[model samples]
Target: MSLEAQYLANKLAKGFVGTNQIESNSRLCMASAGTGYKLSLGADGPPGSYRDFEKADVFFVIGSNTADCHPILFLRMMDRVKAGAKLIVVDPRRTATAEKADLYLQIKPGTDLALLNGLLHLLHENGHTDPDFIAAHTEGWEAMPGFLAEYPPATVAEITGIPEAGIREAASLIGRAGEWMSLWTMGLNQSTHGTWNTNALVNLHLATGAICRSGSGPFSLTGQPNAMGGREMGYMGPGLPGQRSVLVDEERAFVEELWELPPDTLRKDGVGQGAVEMFQKMADGAIKACWIICTNPVASVANRGTVIEGLEAADFVVTQDVFAETETNTYADVVLPGAMWTETEGVLINSERNLTLASPATDPPGEALADWQIIARVACAMGYEKGFSYESAEDVFEEIKRAWNPKTGWDLRGVTYERLRAGSVQWPAAREEGPDRNPIRYVDRDGELSFPRASGRAVFYARPHIPAAEMPDDDFPFVLNTGRLQHQWHTLTKTGKVARLNKLNPGPFVELHPQDARELGIVDGDAVEVASRRGRAVLPAVVTDRVRPGCCFAPFHWNDLFGDCLSINAVTSDAVDPVSFQPELKVCAVGLAKVSSPRRPCPSPSSRLRSSTCTDH
Candidate 1:
């Protein structure tokens, strides 16, 4: 068994099973970026801060709707743009962020690797690389040229469907800039080539010597709140607390000693099962029962058919959440009502590595309780009272402060709610020293431009581009893309409760160009059945130029609760990137068949018509 499977087995032996049962929704989101960051930098977490955007000379944002999703970060990026910094947006949609971009490349989806490598090829071919920095601070770059040689400007232009001039413009902006910052989100992370997409971006920064300076580095925007903190706390399978990996003997020893556990108490191997692998195990009945928390994978993860099958096959399932009703709740044998963020007191770590303390605005209602309280109770019930007897959130934070890896400069000693009440504090804070006012990390290690890699040099990965796992074909004639809505959040457990937010976007709809709709004998407001090899969904159509002629867009917020057979994930493919194990949520091949107009505005799930029939409403 892998270390991840053994870890779960150990937990099951202790009568404790959490995300080890399946996986969090992050598997559908940031898993790829996390994998790429770790492999490239020898660690996860950003090497730059949010403040770098202000000092950046050129900014490139790909696969992110920052203006809508991370509005505050977008506002911060806008500050630099107004101050004369050039902005480049890479996306398929003409989003609010893209509209203001100095250069917008609506490149074909899933072709990020080619576009990025194309940038590198231009940088080297045009004498834009910094040789002194490359020689002194990096390694393994010789292999890059041969690998990237295939991605010449013309070839990249052909593959990306972007003009050759636009490619050069974006390439020149990045190559020529002294201080460049690249930001991306789910667009790059939610693809079959997500890891390579990330490494390819990092390769650009390394080739141009654009990283570890005052205003430059690759920064991946966090879509989920406190995702950085979650990683630091060892929320994933392979990692230990404080950026330590389970496979490292010294790290394992460090954690065991701190926790006062016996020798060899922790797993020595780092072979942890990723989210997709865990679900596959569930479907195979390798895992008998499962426990899930804080996420709704049914509506978020790709290949909902497999996810539903895995859940149905489980011997027992427990789910903990703020809402009593959710798609996952339908499969749960036990539901634990835990307090939401508004009712929890804890510290949230932002993309900038700033720790903001969250104090509960009000107490929990009815039988609901804080998540930590539920967890602490579970530990006591399972006979781990001594280790889990945390009376307050501060107690938990203090433990992490002492337990975090000191070698990685991840000290959290002085951070406390009392001190954080004034404002946010960036990390690498000391126990004796006051809060760190600095936001930058690895800006200049050891008072010099250095890195934490083994050779004190960055490794340039010579990545090759691969097509998306699923491509549009004759049977599945259109590309179906799934993503977030400006008004709705993941699975809509909280946002669905807001009347105003729902008014902004009430139901699921697919965006198709008027040309494609006309050819398919479909129009705006007509029911359409989108069928992939994996699953199918029925959605109303909205004719617009927002999407490419051959592509369709669907927001994933609508769960089964919406009544009509609408779930973009249902029609999504489970084929994941081998490197990151993050599924291809952004690209799936689907054939469109117009459904007959229902007698009453879209009836129950069972009443949905076949995709072949179409009629006037």
Candidate 2:
């Protein structure tokens, strides 16, 4: 048996059974806050209610690729296309999602803040702001117009490469849409300015009163199926289970009381370093140890070469994953084989805040252990026996739910393990008797809508448009954007093992506009050297007009198996967004050159000819 499975089996042998079995439907009825239940009144009954290709009056796609990455969701958008819904794709490149958009606003990389500011300006100028909503439930109203006044459509158009009319139209569409929803993924969050980007989008929705209702609100599409659960379980840095930050003294005290830890043992107000900062600290020898679970930092982090150095520099590095051959595991001092998602009974929270249970379909292979079991054991090893003495995944989940439910208005007593196992429930399932929990939130009992902030008011932030930390200049003329391909998953720990999936896009290739390719003396199937101030990578070039001029895109999934090539992140800059500390993976300046050596021969001529047939540019 793999080490991880063996660990799980041992835990089960020690009398760990599933905790609080609740039906799936019951779980869906609960809310994250555990108080003041949510209600579903319209078409947005449940997260699964909408599918890909479904017609939306106005489709605002920010940082995500609905097609290649989320094909199922993408199909729903296609449904909308057939129904004549206007699709507006905002991305750094002509992604598959962008290609299908009715209007593709190919903005300059990492300039989302500027683009959003311009949209806000247009909305205010055209008198599209919701006056009643703003007066009733928002702060910072007076200072907003002054902040937006500096970002005229023409200024935004100059920086983002979007036409003035296009900017105006996009703003007008969003402002006037009867039902609108905004979808964003890694494109917005995986940047130095990720937080700012998120807040900017939220600012617009708040300005026009477009959130917490059917076909409305700002949705942050998580990358992993269980990333939401991870956040719920306090797996994120400096967070307690149930959306509680560790910085709050009351929250910290509550958690410490639950765990019975001494005041000094638990962190007080320190925020854990973000991904990039963590690695940089490790590289600098500040952080002595790291335990990586379910993620491959070496292949996924920007400037991957630096990530390797950080791992190498760590005094101890532990990698727990289902596969033994991940790029991260190769560098680990100890490789703990972990159970695959299919081999474990757990829960995953989706983008819509719906919690779904994943039952184990098969027994684990070898000694592979479940993630929770490993964590428990580690906790025990650290001498927190009582706190970590959970017998099952259910028990751990119960503790998490309890932590989330505070009696002082944040009660989630209705959602027990028994209820969750029976059915999926939206959060805020405080009153079991409350009118069939909200499908749409922030709407009061009297049907009056509002924001969810402390004062029941949305705060409008005056965010300025800042240029990408790294810009194209004489040294690096091409802007590089990194993202996913249709077939490959993040870091390729599991997806890489599937031969059929690997066949889709076999290796790393820089997608460039035909004009730029010609200018650089590059052709289809030609190897190219892409360099930046941070690092450099060599990959095959697929010259095509599918991409816009002066910008290039590369998928982040390739590694040695794809041809010993460095990951695209090798050259990505480590600059972070000021607010969220997210690395700026969306935009960086790079210089590309044709590889002259025949040592790496181009793909067959037929391959080049076949690739040329699909150009829409």
Q: By lDDT, who's the top model here?
A: 1
Q: In order, what is each prediction's RMSD in angstroms? A: 4.9, 8.7
Model 2: per-residue Cα lDDT over 47-137, one tens digit each: 2224322434787998678788788777877777687778899986777898898778987777888999899888899989888878887
**What are the runs in model 2 whose C-alpha is more than 4 Å off?**
1-56, 405-413, 416-421, 431-437, 448-450, 570-617
lDDT of 1 by residue, 42-99 (tens): 6677788877877999999998888988888889889889999999999877778888
| RMSD of model 1 against the true structure | 4.9
Off by over 4 Å in 1: 1-22, 268-272, 443-446, 570-617
Question: Model 2 misses residue 88 by how many Å?
Answer: 1.0
- Please give the range of 10 consecutive residues that has the lowest summed lDDT in model 1: 1-10
Cα-lDDT of candidate 2: 0.60
Residue 585 miss distance in model 1 (angstroms):
12
